[model samples]
Target chain A: MKKLTKDDLQAIKQEELKKETANWIKVGLSTCGIAAGAQDIYDFLVEEVKKRNLGVSIQRCGCAGMCYAEPLIEVKVEGMPKVFYGKVNKETAMKIVEKHIGGKILVNDHIYDIRSSQ
Target chain B: MQQKRILIKDTDLKKDRTRDFYTAFLTEIQDKKLEEKVQLVRVSDIGIYGKGLTVRVLPENFLYCDVETGDISRIVSESVVEGRPIEALLHKPDDKQLRLVLRNCGLVDPESIDDYIKHDGYQAIATILEKMTPEKVIEEMKISELRGRGGAGFPTWLKWKLTRAVEADQKYVICNGDEGDPGAYMDRSVLEGDPHSVIEGMMIAAYVIGATKGFFYIRAEYPLAIERVNRAVTQAHEYGLLGENILGSSFKLDIEIRLGAGAFVCGEETALISSVEGKRGYPRPRPPYPSVKGLWGKPTVINNVETLANIPLIMLKGGKWFSSIGTEKSKGSKVFALTGKVKNSGLIEVPMGTTLKEIVFEIGGGGIAGKKVKAVQTGGPSGGVIPEDFINAPVGYESLQKLGSIMGSGGMIVMNEDDCMVDIAKFYLRFCVDESCGKCAPCRIGGTQLLHLLEKISEGKGEIEDLDRLRRISRAMQKAALCGLGQTAPNPVLSTLRYFEDEYKAHIVEKKCPAGRCAGLFHFSIIEEKCKRCGLCFRNCPVQAVSGNRDQGYLIFEEKCINCGRCFEVCKFEAVSRG
Candidate 1:
């Protein structure tokens, strides 16, 4: 990549803003999250999303401050309310991709927090 | 028609009626024929604790707490359908945490610079380079009243102004990432989670101080933090943000990473400067402070990781906006590693002046296992303990200091009734003694003496006169110690004695450990009546202290017992008793 100028920085930010609003899954992959088996969860989610040919983008992020509820995943499906699923194992990750992403209904007993779109 | 969502959770841990409420809400929605229009989600955590039956109606984001099953139909019709909030049921949460420093923590990808820029990162530095001068930058910081988050609470602008005023051919700025507090990892989190924000903050600081070069003094223990920061620096360099002529301007700045050797004393500014210079990490006296003579005897400004992280935001939004959130003296939010006996042990960022009660009970979800909280230990080894009686006091630089504690870093360890005061004091004093760099006699000798007296007290061998000796040694260390390590090491001991003196007296006079923490003062015995002959104590005892058969019942061999309390913890029938 070439060195960015002032205008290039703004252009990149604006371009990324448009991409950020699409359907995406963010897994907490910080030290705290990784210690709680988030790496296996991330890998499992990535494989499942590819196996099912789901268009939802899977990404890695950092800790969300909720250390107690580790292995956290935040799912934002278009036209559905964005929610955080915590204490997630492989079983819960499959349910998130199938139920929340595929079937459009939230998985029971796993949703920790909901971010209301305002 | 836009679909409306209703999120429900029972915040009361004592009893969970969330499933029952979910069924009731489903029935009400089905009866009204609005099941297609409304989606009900039974969440595990609603971010509000201790309140019964929390219901949040999305799109409108109406939160109702302590809700009963009877209020379901009214909530469905009035709030869900009508998009109106009921005034009586509406829960307006006060003392809510404000996240400025951690705005992008869990939200953005740490490795992606585009993700950071999308969240309006580096915009402050760009604007600063284009418009503001060094004096103007310092003026803005002065208005914000942003202080050092590394413990001392020094004004950020004053440090910059002093460094800028010095006439030096080359100046330096260092980001102190050597956070060695026992329970604190706030800096590490910021570095790992949002590395770019800290980088931008460093750029803003470098611009203000007119420093061409800067260094990140991160401890080698945080390998992940180092990796992320390293990647962020490389990324910035590629984007023309780190090396020559940043953002089409002549303001060139380069940042390098220097790993600390995990010495607690290296966190002190003078020792940190020494460590970075390829010399022994020993602190020299102040007066020709770091701003005047730092980093190879040149003008240098060293800011904490959290303090530097606040700069970009403070510049982006005006200083008045940043200053409006916190108390009169200490402005802006503070990130605390809330650990220990709290129900929710996590990282929380709250505005300054939020009371300890609010932090512990409200945000932390109170003490673990429904136990009553005993006290809170703030600022790690160099800080003191605040008893439960003063939990209502607002947290500020002066407020915490007035309560015999300093807001050192942001390590808030919530201690419960099960934790012994004598043991807590001993733990912190021992940490200081172990970390005391033996360059100064006052710290080296005084710290060891204090630890010895604490050990004697915990072992039930302490005399009443030993209390006076502890005080005397602590005072001598405070007066004669070279650096912050030894001077503030006695805070934990002094604060505990000030608040829980009765517990200390009990250990001395009655030969009892009130909290049952001092193993030497307490003994484990099997209660014959309460014993079910389960043989759990006999099986679980590491030293084979309990000897008996299942049918015949058990007896504790006091001679064999090492007072490890393994048998006491294994007995489910309340058979094993300790006193």
Candidate 2:
């Protein structure tokens, strides 16, 4: 990458904004999340997404301050409300994919917080 | 397509009526035959406490607290069916948390610079370099009323101005990341979660203070934070945001990272400066503060990680915007590492005036293991304990100080009824004693004396006179200690003594640890009726203290027992009794 000038910073920001992102899943990969078995869940999500050829993008983020609910996963589909699921393992991660992504219904008993950034 | 959602959680401490309320609400919705229209969800936490059966209607955002079975029909009709709220059950929640510094904490991908820039990352420094002058930058900081988040609550602009006033050959800026508080890792989380922000904040600080060199004094314990900060600096340098002539400007600055050798004293500014200069981490007396004479006899400005993290946001949104968030004296949001007995033990960023109750109950999701909260310990060892009675008091720099606690680096540990106040004070005192550099007599001697007094009290050998001696030693340490570490080491003991003198009196007069935490004070015995003869205690006892077979029943030999409480831990039945 070239050394950025002021002009390049804006162009990069604009380019980043213009990128198409329709569906995504963000896992809290901070120390707290990682300590709560988030790495396995992240790997599981990545593997399952690749195997099933899903259109969802998996990203890593930091702690959302709810340490009680670790391995926190934020799932966003096009039509459904963006939901935050917590204390997730491989089984729950798979359930999140099946019911939340495919079936367009939020998972029960695993939802810690629910809000839409959009 | 019409979709409505309702989230229900029982906030009552007595019993969980969430399932009962959910069933009744579901029955009512089915009776109305509007099950398709409304989707009722049972949430684990609704961010409200002690409100008895809470119901939140989605999209319309109507909240009904203390909801009864009768209110379910009205909630379904008025809120869910009609999309309007009933005045009887309407609840207007006073939201205490306002995220400013932690705006990008959980939202963005921490490793990616592009993800950061998309959320206005380098924009603050980019604009500052292009438009603002050094004086204007300082003026903006002054206007923002942003104080230091490193516990002292020193005004940021004043520190910068003091460094700028001195005509030094070379000036340096340091981001203090040596967070050594036992239950505090707010700095670590911020550095890991948002490294670029700290880097940007440092760049902005450097620009204002005319410092060409900066260093990150982070502890070695935080390997992830160190790695992320190293990556962030490299990324900034690559983007022309760090090196000479940053962003096509004449101003030049460079940043470096220095690892601390796990010294709690180094968290203090002068001690941190010495450690950065490759000397033994010891704090010298202040007259020439670090801002005036620091980092190899050159002027230096050392800001805490959280303080530096607030800079980009302040610059981007303007100073006035930042000033509007906090209390009269304290400005902007504070990020606390809320841990220890708190249900939601994590990083919480709330405005200055947020009450302790709001942070502990609402944001923290109340206490863990169904225990009643006893007190909240703020500022680690250097902070005092705020008893459960005073939890409704607003949290600010001055307010916490008034209650015998300083807002020391935002380490808020929620303590429960099981936490003995004397034992709590002893823990912090021990930490300080180990970290003390033995530079001054008051801190070196007084800290040890205070620790001894606490140990004596916790062991049930305390005299009433020991309490007065503790106060005397604490006052001396507070007045005569060389650095911030020594000065504030006595806070825990002093504050606990002030609020929980009765607990200490119990230990002294009755030879009892009311919380049963002091093992020397409380003896463990097996309740014969409750004992299941499982032999678990006999098998697991470290000292072979527990004896006898399953049919004969087990016994804990108090003579050989070291009071380590291992048999108590291994008992399958509720057989182990302690008083």
Candidate 3:
């Protein structure tokens, strides 16, 4: 790879930001989240989304500071509000993929927080 | 029209009324034929505590606290249907948390360089290299009033300026990642969460001090932090951010990582400098401080992990903007590892002057299991306790020092009523005694002596004269010890004695442990009236101390009883009492 100039740094940032906004799922994969089985949730969601041919991206990030609710997954669908589901298991992950992604209806009793884009 | 989301949660811990409220709201949505347009979700946590019922309408982000079933139709009509919020039930949340150091913690991917750059990561260093001079960077830092977050609260600009002013052939910069405070892991979290930001901060510091070499002295225990930082270093080197002639300028820096062998005293600056120079980790006397003579007799500026993480942000936004966020003396936000006896045991960032009450009750969701909070222990072994009465005190460096506790790496352990003050003092003192390097005579002897006195008091063998002895030794240790470890070792004992001396007197004079934490001073007995004769105490006792049958009442023999409190835990009925 070639060394980045000052112009290259600015260009990369702008190009990445301007890319198409797709439906995505971000699982917190920090130590706290990993200790609570976030890796399994991330793997399962990736496999399920692929098998079902869903147009959703699975990404990994660090701890969101709500450690009481670990293994957290933040889902952002196109027409619905973005939300975080905590203490997520395989059953809840499947429900999220089927209901929230496929059916556009949110899964109840599992939502921890809703991020309002102000 | 976009789908309007209604999120509801019953914040009351005693009884959950979310089902009733959800059902009522669903019926209203169905009545208006807005089931598809409006989705009702029964959430687990609404980020508010103790409020009766919290309902938030999304798309508008209108929050209503203490909502009732009777107000459901009005909420559906006014807020949901007409897109307006009611004045009376509208709850404006006062969020006390400000995220400056932790801006990219959970938002950006730690392992991905593009994700970090997309969030404006290396822009600070680029701006510094292209436009600003070394003196200009220090000027901005001085205006920001950003202190060292490594527990000493020293001004960051002065440390850099002092190192810059020195005329040395070779200068160095070290990022102190060896955080050894017992319950504090704020450094570890920041390292693992945002490795590139810390690297960028280090680059900015090195450029200002005119140093081309930097070292990250992290502890050996944090394996993930080490891995991520190593990757980040390689990534920066690959992108021409670490090697010579960075960003098409004359600036050149090479960064390396050094692992500490898990010595608590290595968190001290002098010992850290010694360890980095491939010697035994022991602190020496200061006059030619680290700023003048450090790391092979060259001027070195060592900054904490959290302090370095704040530099890039301070440069991106002007220093005056950073100074406007916090108190007069201390600027910017602080990240705290809030743990122990709190409902939400996690990492929280709050402004410098936010009170303990706001952090504990509003942000922490109060004490666990409805137990009333007794006190809070800050700064680990080197700090003191703040009692419940002073929970309203703000959390600046000087303010915390005035309350007899230093803000040592932001480890705020919330203790409840069951935590005995004497036990708390002993626990911290014992930690210091074990971690003491034994290089100096005063710290080695003074720490051991102070722990013995605390042990004697907890065992109900202390006299009034011993209290005077504790105060005397603590003063001597503060004045005579070599480094910060031994000097501040007596803070926990002195602060506990300051606030909870009455409890200590009860342990000494009355020969009873009020909180029942000290084992031998208290005993367990069964109340005959409340006992169901289930024999659980007899069955659960490890030593077979309780001797009786179901027909006869169970009696605990005083001699064989070890004061283990197993019977107290095993009792299904509230028959077992301790006194």
Candidate 4:
């Protein structure tokens, strides 16, 4: 591999980021998030996504700075609004997949954040 | 497709008229019959403060401040419904938070070494090893004026310089991840969110101080942080960044992970060193500072996790650029774990001298459940509470210390009106007492004694002379304690007494806790007029203390009442009252 310049590095980062769009499920994998049962949620989401063969790209990220409402799952799908569901356990993870992914409907009570596209 | 989206926020912190604005906007949309075209929604938070009625239009990102009901039509016509900014109401130039230490946090995949490399992470170490000398690295640090974020604000360059000056065949650099400050999780976030940044910093420190070995003394409580760090270290070793010839250079440094048993005093430098050396975690004296004679009688440089995370960026960008962001004395951004009764309880990184009010009310979205903010406690057990009046005080090392608090590891806990001053003091004092290593008499005995006095006051058995006893013992601890642990342990108590002495006097003289927090000082009673002859209070009392029929109404029995406030919580009619 050749040593890359700063511009090349930035370009690669941009290209990689471009791949992350449309339907995606991001689990908060940081310490605070994990302590609040994020790992179980992450595993459940992965298993559910695999079992159903859902068109969602399941990924992991660090905390979004809300520890009080951990086990956070951020879902973003094209046409629909981007939403963050907090206090998501295994049951909620399955609901996220069933309702949000399969049914194409947003789940209630668990949605702590909503980012609608106009 | 719709090209415009408007975000409306009532910027007045005094009162939330956002609902009024929301109603008016909805009515205007309905009146104009533009419901299908334009969408209006109520938001939880908008990042502006004290400027009445703020509206931000998306796609164009045009901000309109100080908007009124009358201006809503123009905003609807020009900006929202039409897609152009009302020039008169437009507010431009929003300066955002510049993140340095937390740059990669929440951005990169922590488990991936390739992801870290893709961000130009360890390139700083490679560059340093190839081009820069140890002297030049230290000189760059001095130019940056980088201080320890772990508290005390000691110059980072000086610590490295002192360790570098020592003629030793073996030297050590330790990353102090033993973060036990109440409400503080900045270090844990950094360690778990972006483990590579800290590892990169440790590598730079090793290259500068010529240390062959490094250790991360993280608390055992943060299992995920430990797991991430362990994974990161193993990844770094595999990448040739650790072990022999790191980054394909002659510099060889091996890093290890050590879990602290979660003793608060172990965060202190001397005690941390002792704990790492397999001895009882206790603080010894200074002057033979860790930089000079540390870690098994070898010169050592221990940097906080956040402090180490800043090193890569400082080295990459010129020192002058890094120093220019913060205040005159305090340079660079500080990551504060903003907790307590704030609406948004999490990590916030603001520049130095950014006022406490802005961090609390603005960034943290004010007090929890829209309660009036009373005070903010910083530095955890070693810090003092700043009253609402001093909310405008800038957040820095000197400013916080001058206001009877030290900037101890950036734990900013916002307290609302419901928190009693005396009770708050007692809470922190008791934390220090529980965490005290019991090695020194002043710390062990004085902290215990002060905690006892505070307990007595909160329990309604205190006298005025107890105040004098607290002061005398605080002075003794401040003067005679072995290290930072004992020396600063009495801060929360002393600072609270200094500011809210009247609250203490009230507890002792009037037998009342003004905040209704102290259990012994507070009395729970059922107001007869407010009681609706409901048995809710009677059924809800854990001890069955509220004894009376629904016809006569429930009354709290003074002898049997535990002051648990269960009845108060259960009563929906506001029948139960505490005073």
Prediction-by-prediction clash tally:
0, 0, 0, 0
Q: Which structure is stronger by TM-score: 2 or 3? A: 3
DockQ of 3: 0.68
Poorest 10 consecutive residues of model 1 chain B by lDDT?
A: B12-21
lDDT of 3 by residue, A1-118 (tens): 6767778899889987886366889998888888899999999999999999898989888888888899898999887778899889999999999999998888998888888532
Structure candidate 2, residue pairs in collision: none
How many residue pairs clash in model 3? 0
| Per-model i-RMS | 1.9, 1.9, 1.7, 4.7
Better of 3 and 4 by lDDT: 3
True contacts kept of each: 0.76, 0.66, 0.69, 0.34
Question: Per-prediction TM-score, chain A only?
Answer: 0.93, 0.94, 0.94, 0.90
Model 4: residues with Cα > 4 Å off, grouped in runs = A1-25, A35-56, A68-118, B1-3, B6-42, B49-55, B65-73, B91-96
Tell the DockQ for candidate 1.
0.69
> Which residues of candidate 2, in runs, are more than 4 Å off?
B13-16, B27-38, B527-544, B549-553, B564-576
Per-residue C-alpha lDDT of model 2 across residues B1-579, encoded as one tens digit per residue: 267878887877444466677789889989998878777777776678778888888778788889888888778877887888888888898767777767777888888888888888888888988898888999999999999999888999999999999998899999999999888988888888888999989988888888999999999998888888898888888877888888788878899999999999999888898899899998988979878899999989999999998999988889999988888998888989899998778788899998999899988878998899999999998999999999998889999999988788999999998899999999999999999999999989999999998899888889999989999999898898999888899999989989999999999999999988998998889999999898888888888988889888988788888788778777778799887
**Residue pairs of candidate 1 with colliding backbone atoms:** none
TM-score for each candidate, following the candidate numbering = 0.96, 0.95, 0.97, 0.89
Name the lDDT of candidate 4: 0.84
DockQ of 4: 0.31
User: Residue B331, candidate 4: how far off, in angstroms?
Assistant: 0.6
